[model samples]
Target chain A: MAGAIRLAAGVVEGSRAALSRAITLVESSLPDDFARATELFVELTRQQARRPTAHALRVGITGPPGAGKSTFIEALGRQLLDGGKRLAVLAVDPSSATSGGSILGDKTRMHALACHPSAFVRPSPSSGALGGVALRTHDAALLCEAAGFDHVLFETVGVGQSEVEVANMVDMTVVLLPPGSGDGLQAIKRGLIEHADLIVVTKADGELRAPAAALAREYATAMSMLRRRWRGWRTPVLTCSSHSPADVRAVLGCVRDFHATALRSGRFEQNRSEQELRLLFSAVQGELAFRLRTDARINALIREQHRRIVGGEVAPRVAADCLSTLFVERMRGGQSAQ
Target chain B: MAGAIRLAAGVVEGSRAALSRAITLVESSLPDDFARATELFVELTRQQARRPTAHALRVGITGPPGAGKSTFIEALGRQLLDGGKRLAVLAVDPSSATSGGSILGDKTRMHALACHPSAFVRPSPSSGALGGVALRTHDAALLCEAAGFDHVLFETVGVGQSEVEVANMVDMTVVLLPPGSGDGLQAIKRGLIEHADLIVVTKADGELRAPAAALAREYATAMSMLRRRWRGWRTPVLTCSSHSPADVRAVLGCVRDFHATALRSGRFEQNRSEQELRLLFSAVQGELAFRLRTDARINALIREQHRRIVGGEVAPRVAADCLSTLFVERMRGGQSAQ
Candidate 1:
């Protein structure tokens, strides 16, 4: 408890080192770390409840692997700092195989920004359960806000479904596609159209500039046809070039506009509140899995039902009901201490 | 119990009327209907366990609004009947408003096949919870198989993400794209590549023939580049024209080949077992939500946790643990009768 309190004190004092350590602690998903993280978060939440910290503008940047998301982020990070905004970049790639490369490579790609005192870049948390990783990322973002970052940009690859969860956690989701109109086909595969607040036609450099413009126009037409998920704004498609760096500001401008409009329309708070609700339910799922996994009686029940399910002796849905009834019955038999 | 037995007996006797009624029973998702459905399924499972009934080859067909899925199914149904195969076409559209049009439109599009003695075309079950809808569709498929259908093909619109669930419930998933290569963008929006076991270029007739061929080639190349989730056979992109019923045989042949290779490699059984496991877990989630709604104390606990979550007094993950712990304690306090 004392250690957690000290960590919370360091975190609230705007120590990036403390914030980074807090994130690492929360990322482990171990029971002890989870307990400490909870204590720290509770203290953090209580402190903020009184002090009322300013929430940072959370912008989610997602694209395919080669869409130059990191380069664009580097350019955007520099722009934000130049505009006198403290920025934090958290990349949420939840794959262990690529985590090492992703973390190291991100630092290399954003070398100038990484060295900047105003900019903080943390790689993906160590991957475990997808839900757990998402929870940690959400906490890490809040920690960055508590540490007084003016803006937090979450960058991730959209091939996995993690981006959808990340979108719910952020104020705005920006999906970037490569230049050519043909390449925009990928924007569909990635399921970005529905979730993005802004879509960037990235790598609009050299000879790709004309094609990128055409692609943007094509996407704008496509966007018009689809019903918007949120009110007060329609997702816009724009072009950006890492080489120019100025285009970064254009995308950032759209981000600012979206933030302002969503806040004005009340969707910002509504969306954040809903994200918390979803997080609660998702955590419920995680907790259920944890209990079923760790409790011997629950594990036995699940195994028995699973066997019947696999043996074709009972329907999975029916077996699920049996398991549920048995679980309640077990709990009723006074085995709640564990 | 007697009513359930009667329904089970009739279903096992290959009576389409009984099968349809059993389906309706499962589709309601009402407590009485769910209880009856469970009883009927338990009887059926016990019987099948003793007699080892042959499972039908389940296939899923999904496409965008105008991909000609129903027409192709009509064409394919005739061919299957001509080959003396008993086929069941279960269309699982979960939206009620669209259900009215789909049920009516499909009867019109498939009038000939619907009236044929060996063919059965059931429209989507009445809409409800997506999980419930998915559960009922799966059970309906099993009933159709138990009713002696040699082939049971599930048909649904791909836009709803329902196809992903249907994919898990079936042996093969076919994603249909319209003729034009340009229209293939709809295929992109539908996210057909990753989950599709076969990509069909539908409506390859008249002016659409050349375009359909090109589209098929384009998709074949795209399919090759993307990682194949299923082993033993790579996904094949083929062209099919409703005008040319001969193409139906080619697709059926491909489906059979994929099935044969999968069974040979033991992935078929492995896949089916995994589906059962997934179904069991999904049912657990549904059951949890059901309990949370019905159990007052549990609901109260969840409500309190929700308030804490919304108030930002605790992180959602932490709140979830508190809810789980509270739920068990509530149940342990001799409240099981509810």
Candidate 2:
């Protein structure tokens, strides 16, 4: 109890070392540690999270691997810190084998940014998640706010359908693109493009600057055709070089403008509500699937049904009906009559 | 009733014109016509679809819109025709206002194949689906099979997340890719790729042939990683040039091998059963959501809850819980206690 109280006080007092240790504790997987972590999680959710005026903006940055996301984010972190804002950067990398889970070693990739006064960099591995956003990214973002970080940035590995999942959690989504590669535009998923609050053409430094600018213009024109689902705000495409603070500031200004507009129009709350429902539905579906898979009787019955189906006794629809019925009954704690 | 009887008889007798008309009727939205179509569908499902042994091998071909899907499928159809196989192609195109719904106009794109004796091409526009597959693709596949097509190929507009929904219903999935694009291996989505029984690198002609072959090799290597989840057969990636009949034959051979393996291992029934469950879940979710949107009392309660949520009196999760509780209670006609 004393240790827990000390940890709580350390977090509330804004000790980076203490916060880092707390996050490590949260990410730990050992049975006893996980139980302790769950206690911390519950306490954190109860005590530190109830801020009325001190809301933190959640930003999501995603691009393909090898797209220089770390470098750009490191530069962006410095820019934000210079403006006197505290930032929390969470990069979700692929899972680590040593700990048998995510280590979040993204700080190793952005070494200079790690030592910054007003920034925290945490790398959470993909952990074989198809949707990319580590399940803990949401909780970590809230914790960063509770720890008084003004801004929280989530960096995704930018593979598969994970970008959309990140979009659901953030206030704004920035899609990073590498320059000199014509393949950049083609790789931008329609789903991702639609959800992006801003598109940034990165690596706009050197001889590739002209091509990057051209790509930015192309995205700008393409975005014009997609009708904005959000009433007042239009998704913009911009060019930036990690080497240039001016370009980085311009991107940050866009983020600020989007947030201001969203807050003023009540779209922010609408977006949050939609996200909450989505999370709830996703949780329900995931839990339902997990329960169905783990129920020994149902699993065995499913196998038997599959065998009967192969032997040509039950129709596919009928077998599905039985499963759904069983799943519902089990959810209700027995195979009751429907 | 006589008209329905004639339609049923014509379908059973494998009359080409009758099958085309039946599909047209099924795709119609007119209320009275839909009533008749539903009756026809029920009769067809009962009498014809029960014999899974006689069902056509339903193949789903999907990729990006401009990936030359129609041309490639047409070429493949011609090859199958020459080999004495009757081919029925369902092209699911995005609905354009000027093109009218359910176009079926492939004459301009594949003029030669349209005239082939053993080929029947029907292009149905996606009416309301944001995902690539037309709303009618699944039922159309069933109708085509009932009409005696040995092979019913569903050519979706592209490989978006929604396209996987269509692929789930088909017996085999063939993901088409162009050569020289770095996205070859990146196209392997966890949800979609596992369903992709065969991967065909299309447009592998002229300068692109070498790169296409390389891409195929990369896809095969990537597929090997996923092979652990795959039960018995390997998901082979083959290179094919639509202009080359031999390349087309290679793709055809892969399909035959996949089908034979599925049948021998009894995976076909297992897959179909899983698909049925997914379909039912999707249907229920859709129906419930639509009802929630349309029902006045529920809609009113949801709006009221949203207003409360925006005012910060209630957390979004609690609001959702309340709404879902109300919805489920109303859906069940107040039988269960809230």
Candidate 3:
């Protein structure tokens, strides 16, 4: 306990490496390591300063492959850097080879921004968690804020629901699309259209510029039809080209303006609190489900019922009922201690 | 028990209303009604025909909201009707205002097919399930097949993960899009490109026709990059304009051909069985999680632990371990019989 407290104190004193290591220690999903992780987690939480840093704007960007999302982020990061704002980029990629591990290699795709002194870029791969958002992303975002980054952008692999979770966690969800009006097609896949704060058309350089602008206009129209009213903010559909510095700056300017308003209206704190509460529930639900699945007796009963249900020995409803009753009895008997 | 046996006997004789009612009874999330449902389920399973009628093709269609999904399905259903093929449409639209319950009103959107004599349209709104596929969609599909429908098309509320679930359950997943091209921008959205058996560019009717065709070719190239091959089948990208009957028929032909191949290669049975197994697990998981959450002692402990962790008094890992241990002990104590 003393060693854990001392380690947490080091993390609190702006030690980036220590913070990173601490996060890794805490985020482990392994069953055996959980005890140590919990002890450290308690220390880290208690010792961490409660003082709020100057609020940084959190922007979540998501889309599918070839969506130019990394390019857009790099372009936007440069713009932020040019404005003398410190920026942190957390890029989450798809799991490679289905090994239940992430490649965490978006840094290679983001070259220029990574070279900038004012920017810190980290790429994380999807870890078998239900949306692609790394479970650590939330804590990492806070660490980045404490590290004095004025802006934190979370880049997600283009699977839509993961982005929605990202959207819920961040202040703004900026969905990037390549040139042309094809974005309208993507709307069908994303499912949660109402959550998008902004839609930017990327790769708008050269001849694609005209079409990109047209696509932006088309998206604006589509978004309006979906919302049907003046929301507190109408999602802006704007054209941005990574190859064009001026256009990229405009996207950053829009984000700055959004943050200014959010902070002034005190909406930012409210949003964060709501997100934290949601995160707690999501985590607990996940833990409960995982524990139930790994239970030996319950696992056997579930499998037996599944077989019977499949074999026509029982209906799914009956099977479910039988299982539910057994579970309730288990709980009543205090048999869940491991 | 006798009543359930009688009811099961009625469903076995191919009573449409009885089958529908049986599914409704099974799908009920309530606990008390479950015993009766199970009793009936066992009997129905006993009489489940080894093979019902001739082979029926099950295709899943999913995309974002304004992707003209309803319009496209209407066109596809009309094409099947013209060819004198019996078609059944299952629409999962579970988005609701108060509870997010899907209105399941795709029949209204698909006027032509809804009125067709040879077509049966059932839209089931999602009821809090993560994926847009209805919890009982597999059962419903089976019932539809028993009712003599030669084809079952499952339409999901597209948001990539849900769409993937739908695709996994069905023989084919048709991903619909609007025309135009470019990469990286659209890649951020969740569901679009992955698990797409065929990429169908919708709205190819008007001035967008040429560009739509061009986009189709682009998607064909993109699909090649997404997955080299899936289940020993090469993915195809097709173009369709809901306004064009010929284009619509082309899509139907693809679905038919896919179904024929799946059946011949025994992939169809394998897919259906896999879907059933998945359904079994999903039911068990969902029920267990729900019960654990609502359990009084568990819920109280969770609340207390949450407060302690949030207050920085207890480590999240420690609290989780303690709770998990307690839960396991409770389960083993045979209170599960309660």
Candidate 4:
């Protein structure tokens, strides 16, 4: 209990080491750590409520696996730190279904940023349900803000669903694209492109410059055709080269502009509320999924109904009726008339 | 109670007019009617268990607007009826977000097929949640099969999330495509294309025949690269024209061949159980969503948390924690300790 208080205080006082420890506590699967982490998170939120924050720029970078996300973040992080802004970087490695091993070999890739003061970089695995990991990201971002960071960058590898998740969690989303034809275009989901505030053509160095510019132009045209869901903001496509620090700074410049527009239009607060509501709803859904899987009677009832369904004797609606009935009854710890 | 029993009896006894009435009952939005309809469904399911069935073939057809879905289904229905198989059709109107109104102007489009002795056609508007429509579709299909139909087809418009819902509820999924540049390709989501069992190029008339075949070829090449999730079955692409009755029969033939392969490979029962399991999970999740929306205290708590979050006084994870807490406490009929 005392440890949790110190940890909370340390995080609120901008102790980077304490921030890392707090994240570890929250991500820990142990029940004790989980309980303590919840307490810390609540306290931190209350503290956030009592004090005004610097309104940190929360930006997300997402793309296909080989889109050079880490290198680009490192370059961007250095630029922000040089501008005298405190920054925190969090990397979410996609959960591999086959190996269950995280691809967060990201520390070495961002070695300089990791060593720099006024900058903190952490790479974490998706240790639980996707929603759970998302919730953890939310908690970690708050922790960074409480730790006095003026900017928080969320980096993830993937195209479709993860892009949507990170976009919901951040102020602005930047989709990194590689120079190519339909091969890369197809990999970048249309849904991802729809939500992007900025689409960056990565690896725009040396031989890839011309194709990257062409790809950016193609993206610009496609984006122009899409009616903007948000008022007063249109998604733009840009080319950036990690080799050129100027290009990295330009990406940062565009993000600042987007943030300014969001603030001016009040979408900044609107996005935060929407993101919070989404997390709240999903958390309830996740809890219910937990109940469905963990409840002995409910699980047994579903299996029995599924068995009858497989026998071609029970319809899905009937099965749904029986299961919902059993689930509610089981939750109430009451016996059914049958 | 007597009315529900009579309706159940009428449906099971294969009275076409009674079958339509029973569908109307289950699809009713009134609470009392919903209760009666559920009773009717449970009884019908029990009766179905006691009797022997032909194990109806359930197929799902999905595509973009104007993929010739209704016309092709009408033609296919005639072929199936000619083969002495009873058929039932259900059309799920896309939610009003995109098209604003249903294009399932199916009544006139399928006038002949609807008049056939061995076929039943029903078009349902998305009156509630998509899951509600899906569950109603499940119940309606059972009503038809209980009425002795040997084949059931579930059809929906668009290639977004709703298609995935229908795909989960049916045994075989048929994705329809029109011959075009990247329009159709962009419409088919990556996840949807991965699970497709058969991809059909529609509108293959005399002038469009060549492009249709080429589209089929392109789809075949892409499908070949996808690893089939179901054992011993590969997704195949074919061309069909509504003007040519033989092409209609050929789609039926291919579907039968795929169904036979699934049965021979033991995937038929496997698919049934998997599909049933998915429905069971979604049913629980849907109920949870319903509860979240309806419960006063939970709703109030969520709104309060959302307001705090919007004020930037709370983080998302903190908001989720508070909402979940109030929900549980309210479910217990007690005030939160805080």
Q: Rate the local accuracy (lDDT) of all candidates.
A: 0.77, 0.66, 0.66, 0.76
lDDT of 2 by residue, B113-141 (tens): 67877777776543543111332565576
The RMSD of every model to the true structure, in order and in angstroms, is 8.5, 8.3, 10.2, 8.2
TM-score of 2: 0.61
What TM-score, to 2 decimals, does candidate 1 have? 0.64
Q: Note the DockQ of each predicted structure.
A: 0.26, 0.10, 0.24, 0.24
User: Could you give candidate 1's per-residue lDDT for residues B53-171 as a string of tens digits?
Assistant: 68888998887778888888888888888999999988777555334444323444578877888887787666663346557777888888778898998887776555777787888
Tens digits of per-residue lDDT, candidate 3, B142-239, equal 65665567788888766534666677667778888767434532752335567777778888877888888898888788787775444666678888
Among these predicted structures, which one has the highest lDDT? 1
**Cα lDDT tens digits for candidate 2, A1-338:** 45656775667668887787776665554435534544554455445436443768999988765567888898888888888999998875433422355433445677777788788887664353311233346556655876889999988756555687788888889888776654554655555677789999899989979999998898899999889858998899999999898999999999999989999999887787677555544433333343344445444655676665445454433344455444433333332454
User: On a 0 to 1 DockQ scale, where is model 1?
Assistant: 0.26
* Model 4 chain A lDDT-worst window of ten: A329-338
Query: Lowest-lDDT window of 10 residues in candidate 2 chain A?
Result: A126-135
| All candidates: TM-score of chain A | 0.86, 0.80, 0.76, 0.84
- For model 3, residues A19-127, the per-residue Cα lDDT tens digits are 5565555445455444555566566656554643555788888765566877778777877788798888876543332546553454666888877777777767335
Predicted chain B of candidate 4, TM-score versus the true chain B: 0.83
Name the regions of candidate 2 deviating beyond 4 angstroms: A1-45, A48-53, A61-72, A79-84, A92-107, A129-136, A156-168, A172-270, A281-337, B1-10, B13-18, B21-41, B48-53, B56-121, B124-138, B149-336
